[model samples]
Target: MALTTDTLRIGINKITDQVDPMGAHLNELDGRLGDGDLGVTMVNGFKNIAAVSDDLPDDFGMACMDCAKAMTKVSGSSFGTLMGISLMAVAKQTKGQTEIEWDRLPDLLQAALDAMIARGGASIGDKTMLDSLTAVIAATTGKTSAQDALAAAAEAADGALIEFFDQPCKIGRARIFGDKTKGMDDPGMVAIKSMIDCFT
Candidate 1:
C-alpha cells in the first residue's frame, strides 16, 4: 500500500500509543547507563508528534516535516534531537509526494539513517540509535511491503541489542559508564525496536 498521509498519521498515532507505556521502562534502562530521562523524552516527543499530525498537510512529506518540528519543540535531549533530524531528512527526500511507494521506502529510510549519523556523529558499534537504525535500513533493503520491512527491522533490532549490550558504549552520555555499560541494552536501540514493532 502507498504510504499516504492518513496512513502516516495512523502509524504516528500507533507509535505514540506503543511508546507511551514504555516510558518508565525506558527511564529505568537509561538510569543504568545515561541520564535516566530517555523514556520521558520519548514520551514527550511522540506526544507532541501525535498532537500535530492531524493538522499537518495531506502530503506525507509535509506531515513528516511537521511532526519533526513538533518533536523538536518538546524534545530537550540529544536522542530526541537526533530523531527529529532524521525525520526531517526523510521529509526532504520525500518532499512533494502524497504517498511513498513501497519500493522507495528503503531509500527514504537510508536517507534518514545517513542524516542521523552525520548529525549525531555516531556509527555502528557506538551503541547509539544508529545501530538499530542501520539494522532497519539493512532489513528494509529490497523489501516490497511495510509489514515485511517492519518485521525485519524489529528482528534486526533484537539481534543488534545482543551484540550492542555486549560492548561498552562508545558514544553519547552512556559512554561515561565505560565497561559498566556492558550487558545493558542501549535505551535508544530499545526505543527504535519499540517504534518499529508498532508497524508490525
Candidate 2:
C-alpha cells in the first residue's frame, strides 16, 4: 500500500510518543560526551512537527517538506538541522507523490542518507545518527514490503547501537571526549533506533 499523509502522521506520533519518556535518559547519554540538550532538542523538534501535522497538505511530499521546516524552526541544533535536511531530501525525491511504493523505498532512503552525509559530513562508524541510518538503508535494501523493510531497519539500528557502545565518538561535540565516550551508546544512534522502532 502507498504511504499516505495520515499514515505518515501516525508514524510520527508513534515516534514522538516513544521518544518522549526517554528524553531524560537521552540527555544523560549526551551529557557524557556532547551537549546535554540533545533530548530536549529532539523532543522540541518533534513537538513542533506534531503541532503542524494536522494542517499539513494531503500530499505526502508536501507534508514531509512542512515537517522539515517545522523541525528546523523549533530546534536549531545540529541534530535538528540534519533531521530537517533528511526530510527535505526525502520530500525532494518524492515530490508530487501522495504515497510511496515498496520499490521506491530504496531511492527515498538513499536520498535522505546522502543528504545527511553531505550536510553532516559524517559516515558509518562516526558514532552519529548516520551510523544507524546507514544500517537501516543497508538492511532494507533488498526488502520487498514496507513492514519487512521497516522491521529490518529497526533491527539493524538496534544492532548498530550495540556496536556503537564500544566505539569512540569520531565527529561532533562528542568527539572531544575521545576515550571517555567509549562504552557509551551514542545518543543520536539511540534516537534513530527509537524512531525506527515505531514503524516496526
Q: Which regions in candidate 2 have their CA more than 4 angstroms from the true location? A: none
Total clashing pairs in model 2: 0
Candidate 1: where are CA atoms >4 Å away?
none
Model 1: per-residue Cα lDDT at residue 151: 79
State how far residue 96 of model 2 sits from its true place (Å).
0.8
lDDT tens digits, residue span 1-200, model 1: 87788888888888888786787888898887777888998899989888887798987788889988888876456878888898899899888889788778778878888898888888877888888777777877888887887778789888888868788999888888899988888888888887877877
Q: Which ten residues in a row have the lowest lDDT in candidate 1?
A: 71-80
**Model 1 pairs in collision:** none
Give the TM-scores of the predictions, in the order they appear. 0.95, 0.94
The lDDT values for all models are 0.83, 0.83
Tens digits of per-residue lDDT for model 2, 9-99 = 8877887786677677788887877778888888898888989989989878899999999999864458888889999998998778887
The collision pairs in model 2 are none
